[model samples]
Target chain A: MNGVHDLGGMHGMGPIDPEANEPVFHNEWERRVFAVTIATFGGGNYHVDQFRHAIERMGAANYLSTSYYEHWLHMVETLMIETGAISRDELNAEQTKLAKEAS
Target chain B: MAVLTADMVAGLASTGASCRLDETVAPKFSVGDHVVVRNINPTGHTRLPRYVRGKRGIVDRDHGVFIFPDTNAHSEGEKPQHVYSVRFTPRELWGGDASERDSVYIDMWDDYIDPAS
Candidate 1:
C-alpha cells in the first residue's frame, strides 16, 4: 500500500508526515477492530445493490473528495447509532467529554 | 429506567447479514477493461468512497466475487452487488506527476463497469 507521503504532486498536494504513529486508543484489540473495518470499507469502488441504478445520481464533489477510512468511520458511526449500539445523545456526550478533556 | 432486553439486543445484532469471504466465484471483469466506480451518496448512509466516483479504473485483478449488501446504508433493505478487483494507475487517476508505477487496487461492484473500448 502507498503511504500517504507517496502522494506528493499527484493531486498537486504536498507530502504528508511519513511517521508511523500509534492508534488513538490504548487497546490493541480496538485498534485491530478499527483496522479491520478500514481494510474492507476503506478503499475502492463500492455500491448498494437496490440503489445500483442510481449511482450516477451522486454529486461530483462528494464523489471525489472523501477519504477511505473517513467513509468507513462514517458508515460505522451511522450503523452504531441507528442500531442503538450507541445513541445520538451518548455519542454527542462522549465526544463533548473527550473534547473537553483534551483541552 | 428499564434494562435492555435480550430481544432488543438481538434485534440490533440482526440488523443484517455481513459480507463473507468467498474463494470460488469468478470476477466479471479483467485487467485493462475501462470501468467506473459507482458514486453513491445517501443522506442516510453508503460505503462507496467519495473520491472514486466517476474516475475510471482498469481491472487489475479478479479478487473473485463475494456477496456485498445492496446498501448497508439502507438497513438491509436491498440486495447485494457482485464485487470485483479494479486498479487505477496513479497517472490515470491523478494526472501527470503521479508516480508511473503507483496503482491503487479497489474492489468494485459489477454494475460500476461498462465497456471502455
Candidate 2:
C-alpha cells in the first residue's frame, strides 16, 4: 500500500509552508467533519489502519487538491458505504437535500 | 492514581490482541545479523514502510513478539511474530552520496525480512 500518502523520506516535495496565524480549524464545517468522522470510526465501522488505507486509496490528483479535512470527509463517506452504514445513493440524495436546504 | 469509572472508558481500548510478550520467543536472528527487508507491494494494510522495502540492514535488537499489523488490519488474525529493530544505513537505501552519519531503524516482522546473502 505504497500510496502517495507515504511521502516519508522522498525528495522534491519542496519545503513545508507553516501558515501564519492559522486557527485550530479553518471552519465550523471542518470541526464537525472531524468530530463525526472520529465518532463513526470509534464505533468500529473500520479499523484505524483500514481508515488510513482508505484515505491512501485516493488518486494522486484528488489527494493533492483536497485539504486535510476533505480527505477525512471523503473517507467517512467511503467507510459508511463500505460498512453498509449508508448507501451511495442515500448519501448522495442526502447531500442534495442539504444543499437545497442550505440555499 | 485516582480510580476511573467504567463510563470513562466506554467503547475505548476495546480491541486488538495485546502485542507484548511475557516470555521470550525464539528469535530467527540475533543482534548484528545482516538482513534485507523483502520487497513486497501489498494491496492491503501493512506496517512495513515503503522506504525500507528490499533494502539491507543489520539487526539491532529483538523487540520480541507483536501482533502482525499486516494481518490484523484485514482481520485475518493477529499472527503475532518476532519483530526486530533493523538499522539501515542511508547509503544502502538511497544509493550514493547520501548521509554517512545517518541511518534508519525500522521494527520489522519475521515475514518481512531475510538473511542478507
Which number leads on lDDT? 2
- Of the candidates shown, which would achieve the greatest TM-score relative to the real structure? 2
Off-target runs (Cα >4 Å) in candidate 2 are A20-22, B1-26
Q: Give all TM-scores, in the order shown.
A: 0.46, 0.81
Give model 2's DockQ, 2 decimals: 0.36
Pairs clashing within candidate 1: A48-B70, A49-B70, A63-B50, A64-B50, A64-B51, B31-B59
Instruction: Kindly report which residue pairs in candidate 2 clash with one another.
Output: none
Q: lDDT tens digits, residues A30-87, model 2?
A: 9999877766765557767667777888777899789999999988988789878789
Kindly list the per-residue Cα lDDT of model 2 for residues B49-74, writing each as its tens digit: 88889899999999888777788767
User: Which docking category, incorrect, acceptable, medium or high, applies to candidate 2?
Assistant: acceptable
Give DockQ per model, in order.
Answer: 0.08, 0.36
TM-score of 2: 0.81
